[model samples]
Target: MKQRAITGLFFIIVMIGSNLLGSYVFSVFYLLLSLFCLLEFYKLVKQGGMQPERFTGALAGVTLFFFFAANCYFPAYKYIILLPILLSFIPIGELYKKSEAPFTNIGFTYLGLLMAVVPFMFFHAMAFTRGDGVFNFHVPLGFLIMLWSNDTGAYLVGSKFGRNKLFERHSPKKSWEGFIGGILICAFAAYILSNFYTEYNRFDWIIMSLIISNFGTMGDLVESMFKRSLNVKDSGGILPGHGGLLDRFDGLLMAAPIVYAYLYLISN
Candidate 1:
């Protein structure tokens, strides 16, 4: 328990610190994070007997992130068009590997990018969502706060009063009671943030909370389904009690893109 607490504290510090530092720190921090997480995903896929192009996939994912970062920073640069061209090499390179499941390899490689990289790119872009290329930490920080609130609420509420299974097939431990509790708590966090970030009204925060709670839970279930399919226990043991980067950021994987879209639509 102590180890878990320490690790969790350090994790939050690093995450929040990078965000508070500035755009450069945030970009570099998440870029490396996305890369490592992508590598971890490929490792798990390989463990499942599929040969994903780890090197090419990681490189593609990192390059895709850089494209997004550069676009966010420069906005006037036309360099983003190179991403698709780079991604096309994944399959072309796979032709030489002589793997029996060449298509499977290519598919999982792209899946890794989708699952591990793209969502984070959206998240990092949230810092510059205003179209001014100026970075603000409020949205990203609020997003994290709400996510943490949901997790904490779900765990406490579910552990104590959970009766009905939320998804017994994939995650038997999850409960509908816990799910509701999470949303309520997450909504409360958003409400609090609304007071400080008066730029967006309370309604926007509430809506984002709902998105994060529901989709974040879905992400957790999806990861659980994935690990179950592989007959694995945890994604990885990098964190003392938290499993891995994928396990920690699984919620962000599904929630960030949707929230970014919401923010973008409303901002424009």
Candidate 2:
């Protein structure tokens, strides 16, 4: 319990530091983290008996994210059009490799890109999403704040009053009691955040909070399903008590893109 709390606090500090530092730090931090997560996904896929071209796959995912970052930060950079060319390495590299399921490998490689890399890229999208095309820390910061609040509330509430299983198959610890508690707490946090980060106003913040809370639970379950298939307890040992980067960001994977789309549609 102590280890989990310490690790969770350090995680929050790093995220806060990245957001407070500015766009460059935030971009570099998330990009590198995305690459590490891509590598971990490939490792798990390999453990499932399909051989992924790890180097090419990871490189492709990283390059795709970098391409997106450059495009968002500097619009003219979009003309570079190098992402497609870079992604070609996946299948071309597979030509020399020996795998019984070449297409399966390619599919999972792209799945890693879609599931993990793309979501992180969407997080970047949130920063520069305003019509003015300037970075805003509050938007992304609000997301992290809400997500953490949901997790904390769920753990505390579920541990105390949980009686019904949320999804006993994929995650035995989860409960409907926990999920409802998390959503309510997140909505309350959204109200507080509205007082400070008022660009979205109080109503919008609560709506976004509800979206994140519900989908974030789904994302956690999705990752749990992945690990259950692989018969592993944790994604990786990178974070001492928190598991791996993948484990940590599972909720973000499910929440960020949907929230980004919602934010875009409403704002624009």
Cα error, residue 235 of model 1, in Å, equals 0.9
Expressed as tens digits, the lDDT of each residue in 1-268 for candidate 2 is 8988898889889989989998889899989989999989988887888888788878888788887787776674655577678778788877888778888888888899987799999988899878576889898999999998999899989999999999999999999999999999999999999999978889999998998999999999999999999888888888889898889999988899999999999889
lDDT of 2: 0.88
Alpha carbon lDDT of each predicted model: 0.92, 0.88
Q: What are the per-model numbers of colliding residue pairs?
A: 0, 0
lDDT of candidate 1 over 73-111, digit per residue (tens): 786357767778888899999978979899999999999
Least well predicted 10-residue stretch by lDDT in candidate 1: 75-84
Off by over 4 Å in 1: none
TM match of model 1 to true structure = 0.98
Which 10 successive residues of model 2 have the least lDDT summed?
71-80
The regions of model 2 sitting more than 4 angstroms off are none
- TM-scores for all candidates: the values are 0.98, 0.96
